[model samples]
Target: MSTDNSEHMRTIDRWLAGEVVNNTIGIKVVGGPFDGRTKIVLLGEDGRPPAVIRASGGPAGPSRHAYEAVRSTDVRAGWIYTYTGPEPATES
Candidate 1:
């Protein structure tokens, strides 16, 4: 379990560091079934990191809403996806 956490942390670290790009990365639910609770993910460009974006209220349609809203202003400040799954168990 620690290994899984560590791997996820590393991936997030890379993503936060801007090492990843959008549209090239793909996400997968590795630990459990895609129950809509633990299957949300963020994809990035090839050879880059990926980030998972979440909102304050809850899950909503138009996954790209947040991405588009943020990207419209800055264009390169955050992840390119809106999360709609269970909260991450561990954060680094």
Candidate 2:
């Protein structure tokens, strides 16, 4: 598959336009379907990355998977996360 991260870049652009500042961080996924994939996420006001990150394989219904932040030695490039599993069912 193509390794284009333009979508992630667009997210960062949007954040910049909104004056979000320098809270963007890189997240590396480990274990699961999206293993080895990297994503860009915005850090919270407290300078802490998100606890969980969600993504989909295509333009489908709900997200295909979720990743939980396990640890991070460096917020810029060492944020390590693991795939939790498929998205939980939601009430209709």
Candidate 3:
């Protein structure tokens, strides 16, 4: 991997490790802006969790996921600014 990519992963790792997104519930990961990359962004309801996660391979990067809790008088923006991966899976 290149230096830029390395730095990107490192930074993302640190953020993931920190108090950004929570793992309380299973997350939904999707592809990212960059190729071979995936990311998850959270816009907490009522102004709570607003975090971003982006990862790539290099030792192979990790998958990303985010979830938002619902609250009255608030609308989550996570869906608005998230990566649109390939089509969803469906049962035949």
Candidate 4:
């Protein structure tokens, strides 16, 4: 099986083993303004991430940036999110 598939299976195995898997998942962003950034995002009850994510602008201001999930891939360490662009009016 592919490495990606293996990683997914491991996650399932952990759940089956009664391990308290964390709802937060690591994600590497690709493309868009926040490209090449990595962050930890919350996952839904169904073990899926939100279609869109908002990141804090930190230091620059209290504004937040939005990134739409274009694609995702499972890896041993975490998942990857390919973002397209920041959503309009997402900043504050």
Q: Which candidate leads the pack in TM-score?
A: 2
- List per-candidate RMSD values in Å: 12.6, 7.8, 12.0, 9.7
What TM-score would candidate 3 get against the native? 0.26
**Candidate 2 residues 1-92, lDDT tens each?**
23468765766665433323467766677777777666667888876668898887743444578889876664335467787888877777
Arrange candidates by lDDT, descending.
2, 4, 3, 1
Best-first order by TM-score: 2, 4, 1, 3
Question: Candidate 2: worst 10 consecutive residues by lDDT?
Answer: 12-21
The global Cα lDDT (0 to 1) of model 3 is 0.38
lDDT of each: 0.36, 0.68, 0.38, 0.60
Worst 10 residues of 4 by lDDT: 70-79
What tens-digit string does per-residue lDDT give for candidate 4 at 1-54? 999999988876664332335776556676655676665566778666677777
Write down the TM-score of every candidate: 0.28, 0.60, 0.26, 0.51
List, residue by residue over 34-83, the lDDT tens digit for candidate 3. Answer: 43232344435643444444333333234333322223222222222244
Candidate 4 lDDT: 0.60
Give each model's clash number: 6, 0, 3, 0
* Candidate 3 displacement at residue 64 in angstroms: 17
